[model samples]
Target: MILAVVGGKGGVGKSTVAFGVAAELDAVCVDADLGMADLPERRGPDLHDVLAGRAAAVEAVDESGPVDLLPCGRTLAGARASDPRALRAALSAVEAEYGRVVVDCPAGLGRDSGAALAAADACLLVTTAERAAVADALRTRELARALDAGLVGVVVDFAEETGPLRGRFGAPATALPESEAVRRATRHGLPVGEVAPESVVAERLEEVAALVQRSTRSV
Candidate 1:
């Protein structure tokens, strides 16, 4: 299954969550965050190279899971616009190579993000407590529906809030605080389950993995 994690806002921790779930399941993360390939900085071969045919998918795989990665190969000096046809071919190669492909899509509703979602079987929508972020998420969902992709989860990360006050948002507006732990892990190039084993983020990632497993089984 190709599970893509995406958000309207940049800071919502989509890649971090991607890392977490893929790490837990021992699955590949196809880092489609092309505009800013953070996965390579933390862990990878820069998928841009793979897409460009400069490298093989196996060569780009991060081995974080037993999991491989197809890092964004497009470069800092690369074209501003992505070649959708090329990306599609690359993703087809990736999908054939891995058991699970978790794509960390670039934020917002744009061609790059659209290309990533178009390749994915489903997506995990990441959101925040902020209203604008939620609106973006909703739009993202609408886009996903239009693309006929399944939505697996809605991750609500709250890295900013603290203490008991943070608990308020947990029940209604969010899924719990995956934000804080994920932030630390992503910054350090570690998966949340690895960086903070007991964190809510880690536990949530486990749940997400199980859900993915179930979905794949059904398929």
Candidate 2:
């Protein structure tokens, strides 16, 4: 299964959620945010190199973390040189070998984000409980439909209240409470489960992972 983890807005913990889902599922997480990558950096070829025709997609795989990663470059030059259309081929290679690939897509409906959505079998929308963010997620949902991708579910990160959002999206939404463990895990380049195995955040993410798994199985 190839899943694209996307957010309606930046700074909503989309990448963090993506990494956690991938780690829990033991899938490869690819930083598809070529221009503003938030994943941990490694000293080697990345998604930018793959898109720029400088490196093979499989060759860019970095297994030095809890979950395997295909990180993106943070430099402006790297992002500028990347070909958005090349992402299809890049994703194909990883999906072929890994069986499961979760792409941490950039925010908005831009070409780069579209490319990742187009290549995904399904997508998990990430957003906050705020009205504007949920509205933004609806736009992303439309884009995913345009690309003929299925919607796995929605993940409401740092959610303190979930009442108003129930039945708002056509798909189910999981609310993950704000937790300090998420911060520590991200800072240390680890999954939330590793940092806080007994935390509510981790348990909620496990439910999200199960939701994704069920979606894949149904397909």
Candidate 3:
């Protein structure tokens, strides 16, 4: 399964949610945000290299971290040289080898984000409780539908209340409340389950993961 974790804008804890879900699923998380890679970095050929034809997709995966990741190069030249069209094949290759894959998609409704959603079997929308963020997520949901990527679930990060979000996106929504433990885990490139397994945030993330898994199975 290839699942794309996406947000309508940046800084909505999209990468954190992607990493957490990947960890829970035991899948390889690809940093598809070529221009602004937010996941942990490693010394090896990355997604940019794979997209640019310098390395194979399976060879670019780095398993040294808490989550297996196909990190992206943090260079403007690399991002420019990489082809977004190649992402579909690259993600397929990873899925064939890894069994399951999670993509940390670039923010917005641009070509890069479209490429990720187009290649995914399904997607999980990540957003905050703010009105503007929710609005953007609604727009993203439409794009995902247009691209044929099924929307399995939604994750509301740092949510104060989830009452308004339910049934808004045509998918079940899970709220992750504000927590210092989650913040620290994200800062260190670790999942909340690994850093604070007993915390409320960790349990909520697990629930979110389970929700996604169940939704995918039914699809």
Candidate 4:
């Protein structure tokens, strides 16, 4: 299944959550954010090359990592040259090879982000505890529905419990408390599960991974 891990607001731990879930599921984490790409870097053709017709999707995959990643080029020119419409075919090739594909979507419900959602079988919305963040998540949830993507649920990052997020968007929620492990792992461009296997944040991410897997079976 292709699962899009999205956020309405930036700085909500969206990419980190995407990396963690992909690591737990042994899935390919595609950095779909062409402009603001945030996954670990690799020295090769990346998502930019794929979208720009310079490389095949499979050939761009970097396997030597805490997890497999279809890294995106961090260049304004590359992002401008990329065609959002090409993402569908690229993602299709990935889904063909990997049993599970997790897309680290860019913030907002823009054309690029929508393309990611449209290519997914299911989605996992990411947000923080702020009201504005939750509001953005609601918008993201609506976008997922409009695209007919199955939403696994919402994940409230940097929180101890579900708090007031339960049933907010008509979906189940899993809250991950603020952890130094998450900050540290992300700071070093590593998966939290690998860096802090025993931390509470890693445990919650594993639970979220299980939830994403269940989304596949339910469909």
Count of residue pairs whose backbone atoms collide, per candidate: 9, 0, 0, 1
The sequence of per-residue lDDT tens digits that candidate 4 reaches over residues 31-73 is: 9999999989999999999999999999999998879999999
- Which digits, one per residue and each the tens of the lDDT, describe model 1 over residues 61-107? 66654336566655665434445547666766666776667778889
lDDT (C-alpha, whole model) for all candidates: 0.70, 0.91, 0.92, 0.91
Model 2, residue 32: displacement in angstroms? 0.3
TM-score of each: 0.83, 0.97, 0.97, 0.98
Looking at model 2, the pairs that clash are none
Evaluate residue 49 in candidate 3 and report its C-alpha lDDT on the 0 to 100 scale: 96
Model 1 alpha-carbon drift over 4 Å, by segment: 42-45, 64-67, 79-82, 159-174, 178-180
Model 2, runs deviating above 4 Å: none
TM-score of 3: 0.97
In model 2, what is the error at residue 130, expressed in angstroms?
1.4
Give the distance in Å from residue 35's predicted Cα in candidate 3 to where it truly belongs: 0.6
Q: How accurate is candidate 1 locally (lDDT)?
A: 0.70
Residue 215 of model 3: what lDDT? 75
Alpha carbon lDDT of residue 168, candidate 3?
92
Per-residue accuracy of model 2 over 60-133 as CA lDDT, tens digit each: 99998788999999889999999999999999999898889999999999999999999999999999988888
